[model samples]
Target: MKKLILIIGLASAALTFNSCERDITSLNEDPKHPTVVPSGVLFASAEHALLDQVLSASVNRNITRFFTQQWAETVYVDESNYNMTARPIPRNHYNRMMASASAVINSPGVLSALRDARKFLEDEGVGAVKKNNNIAMIELVNVYAWANLVDTYGDIPYFGALKATAENPGNAEIPYDDAKTIYLDLIKRIDAAVAMINISEPGYSNDLIYKGDMDKWKKMGNSLKFRLAVTLADVEPALAKTYAEAAFNAGLFTDKSDNFGLQTFPSGLLSNPVYQDVIQSGRNDFLPSDVLVNFMNSKSDPRRDVWFTKVAGLYVGGSYGDENTFSDFSHFTNAISGENAQGFLLDYSEIMFLKTEAAARGFSVGGTATDLYSDAIKASMTEYGINDTTATAYIAANPFDAVNWKKSIGEQAWVAMFNKGFQAWNFTRRLDFPVFTNPAGSLVEGVPVRMFYSDQEYLLNATYVKAAAQKIGGDKVTTKIFWDKF
Candidate 1:
């Protein structure tokens, strides 16, 4: 009887151990739950929340750097307002951002987080947790995505954000939203965010963008609204005027201090990704453009010195191409090993230029065109250490003639946006200013209007691509966005 009892005890112990092993194995097997919290947050943020704001900030800044290089001038991708060395493969910010956004957008878990925001708001009540904070974040995310999509593809999925679920299903294969529809939706989302915000409560915490500052978020929202309205000026002038007036009444970014931007860290893995890549890898691949260099030189603009370094009395920069080819001209061929390199989303100078353009167009946004234009110019010069005398002199010599003002606006904005590709690309598309003559040997056949749908989109979302093509009139390089009106 004693032997039988001991056998039974041992059997029970073995069963318990097996059960524990099963639980441990299951934890490792689960693919849906990400291992890291910050990674999860970043994934969610990239797709449904505010990833592009950060990603584009980095990527656009780099593009500006590239434009300052030789290729933009020789090929005419951007008119060289600044003389540069050679062009590099337009750094892949769009690819990286798109990949991150796509991973979250296509994932079921991330989608649930986005959908849960609505429920959390409902349960907590709009005012209880300052519901507008959540709404504002969501609105900002959607707007960023929309801007990126349209800027890259002209038209894309706008209304079907988190709404496209199993029930009340939207066409995953939905057609592209017209530019007009997209702009209208952007305004509506901004309005909703503004209305939902209750500045009385303690603000949000995990908000990586504004960090619980409802007032600043409101300012950003208003500024974004103004930006969208201005983008539509060529396509729908009447509506644009109304929205611009509303933005002005709401109060736009008042100063550089009020500018919406991301502050990158000096070190740690999360330090500005661009700075990390460029510094560590010795991969400074972009060169300044000749068109820009000539323009700056003509005005005796002092910013040139701050932006580019002189090698043997010639402003030199790296080139974009295969590793073998790039090695020929680029000086820094190893990882970047310095500090102080960082990224910015939007700056005071950019906001100033927006206002300058609005004033130039007589859009009823208070401020004289010349004053705003001069302010924008000076702000840019200050960034590059061009003294006040030079800045003032450049402004005086450049003046604000309608024809010349348009050219100056494009050139100045382009210079300010140096290293930021999407902004330059967006500005080029909307205004077609700076009238850059294309380089003789661009790999891209012509100035590409939008990026080709990612390989993943081509394979997995082919149906959606086909439908989008039908709506946008062929998903090719030439298909213009609604605002393009080409």
Candidate 2:
């Protein structure tokens, strides 16, 4: 009888429609959930979320490692075989982009953070130089979020994404921007970000990536500019050259110390994504791909030991699209096993390789292809803790193939970025070297060049989503994204 009365009471309360006059009191404020948080807090959350996107190795969703062939699956070979849509990778990323990333732009907390920071600076009589520097620093984080969106999905919500409802009441769908236009705009924003940097201004102490170091942030901004510039090298040589030279002059990652990546914590839910997936999850779903281990073994590359643990004195790997026993194949070494493993967004080795490629095309990115090529290899070696003597010997053995510098540089870059599968995949798509074989007669199609837009997105904005798919060659995994101009 008491339970029945409680149910009746719940239904009665649910049916009672309270108007603003009666219910607009403290009822709206839930003690457990605050309506307001710090902007620094929101920024930190977004950064942490972005790190998850970068370090994602989940077989069901992530396609990056599959694209790079760095690691392969032991079971559930769908991702390794290029079956992206079979899972929710696109939806997951799209949601992250729409929610967490968009919050950086739309949330009141973030807006207040930026506004209050600028106001504080203004009140301190901090000149325009410092103020602009501060704004640029924040904008750098914005561009980083934007870059991930562009690189993964190609055309996406840009001009109208995340606008306030007042700006566009009942806004159901946002328009999309093509990759080319997005790239150009990002370059412009980066240029602004770099220009506004006044080292004298204080860096945001809440910054997790650079710890409020304006110089490091400045290098990262310039590095990003150059990376974007290089991505357009094939289709827009003029702009590519302009931005490349500008980025070079502006400065870039001089060493491994300058890499723009997250140094994950040793505790809590914030452990390195790879470590979280592999260790804490207690799942050995992945092993080194045969393509990766064989390539390393073919040249006796010392990075093999640094990257993987030998199984029975052999650095063996599974064939693409095939499964191997967890113990039969080499597993990832301690380099990426710890909670504190560094998850790099961009690294010095990649910058060196980019310079090598630019020099190959006579873009004057500092030195000959060979010089930059050697330095790139050495940088990778140094980053992996290989000694100077060993690095020099390896470089001596593998002089830049003057006859085929493109393949040489591309292949070397491919090896240098062992764990960073996203950039590795992008470099492969752009450079088109070390051409990989299709996943050994996988049940699905060939390796995906780009991911498919989710059906949910399609249904939500069928017209524009379909238009994007049509523009990008029918939304298939086989379709090459813009800048993948092979």
Candidate 3:
């Protein structure tokens, strides 16, 4: 009897083990689920969420600020040994901007999100839902992407974005399109987006950027269009005049209230990445270039105090080459304090400068070049909490030169763009006004016209990069884009 009972128990245990194994095998055979949809993550309401990540990862904060000052032609090189003559960083703002543009253009998920938004507008007739908000989001992404592409590579994959693939890939070897063509397409897209806004629909919810405000989005779309129109003043005067007139007539950003930007706080993961790094390491990698510090100092610009902090009684900044050095810098502490800083997308001052340039170029805008230029200066100072008295004095001291309109326009725009590297980089390449000298040890000589095709592209998209290089004349760092002909 005992032997029989033992045999039954052994058989039962075998059966149980087999059953468990079969179940486990069945589970393993099923396909694994994707972690989450890409659109859900990439299409967040906060426009700056992706931007912040890309900026922090690609360009160190100190480095970006230095590039801004340098490219805008606002600063001068004072350190000779450091070669303050070389390109600041090989993959500084220009490279990062190009990479980000490619990601946005190539990502299937982002393309789908944009298409869905557009379809929603068409089906819902702009008023059936919060159509305008969706349009705004689409326009924001497109505008940002277009601006980045133009600023970096000059001609880029614009109309064929998301359509280029291994099969049926038109322009897989994208030849550099004229800057004029790219700008025109951007304008058309912006107009279509603005037209979709219907005030009656439910506004955007979960909007991380504007927090469901359709009116603000409308203003932003118009303001951005105006900014783009103004950018073409030097290259395409007739089209620039037409677009500027249209944008102004359509109601462009009128004040700081109309500025489109995101305010980053210190509490969450969303805090300014630059501030986070500074606080975490207590080392500020950036030093203010003598070029920038002296420029502001020469004009007695009160913005110096607002933009930088004093250290050891000297208005010192983190020098470009002082990253690993232990030397005490003047201006701001090389230490990255966790100070709250806002990441501006498009500011009133930038818009003002654009208008100033357009007006100076004889566009039929409501303001004169001097009017727009002075307003830009005042707006910049006011934004930084600089006293009005100081702004007035600076303006008076550095009067606008009508004969040298480009010089005046470029200088003021550079100053206004203080920490905004994207704008500074674009202005520098497009206008070449502020006349920046290369930093010491730059691999490429003279102003780098185009960013070296990224290593990732070389490794993954070798064929595509090769084709693009061929079209643009060469894959070298010194290859000039079409618009660099200033």
> Highest TM-score: which candidate?
2
- Tens digits of lDDT, candidate 2, 1-486: 243233323322221211111221223364532223333434444455566666777764466888878788886787777766667777666655454122212212222233333333444454576557667777776777677677777888777665433333332666788888988998898988888887776565556677667899899999988888888988999889988988998899999888887644545566678888888888888888899788878888988888888888999987777877787778887687777787888889889988888888778777888888888999999988999889888888778998888789878899898788878988888888779778774544666677777656776667788888888778777787788888
Q: Rate the local accuracy (lDDT) of all candidates.
A: 0.53, 0.71, 0.57
Tens-digit per-residue lDDT, 302-395, candidate 3: 7776666766765654454333232554434322224456666687888888888788878877878887788888988887777788888889
Of candidates 2 and 1, the better by TM-score = 2
Model 1 lDDT-worst window of ten: 82-91
Task: For candidate 1, write residues 1-486 as lDDT tens digits.
Answer: 243233323322322222222222332355543222222133234332222333322333233333323233123333233211132212132233332223322222222343343433454443555565666665665565566666666666556543443343322444445666777877888888777766666355545446667777777778888878877878888888898879878977775555565543335433445455445445443344445556666766666666655556654443232122332232321121133443445556666777778777778877787788888888877755578888898889878666666676877787676655556666666767666543454444445555544444545456776777778777555677778874
Q: Point out the worst 10-residue segment of candidate 3 by lDDT.
A: 71-80
**Number of colliding residue pairs in each model:** 44, 0, 25
CA RMSD for every model? 10.8, 8.1, 11.9
TM-score of each: 0.75, 0.87, 0.77
lDDT of 2 at 260: 83
- In model 2, what is the error at residue 66, expressed in angstroms? 0.4
lDDT of 3: 0.57
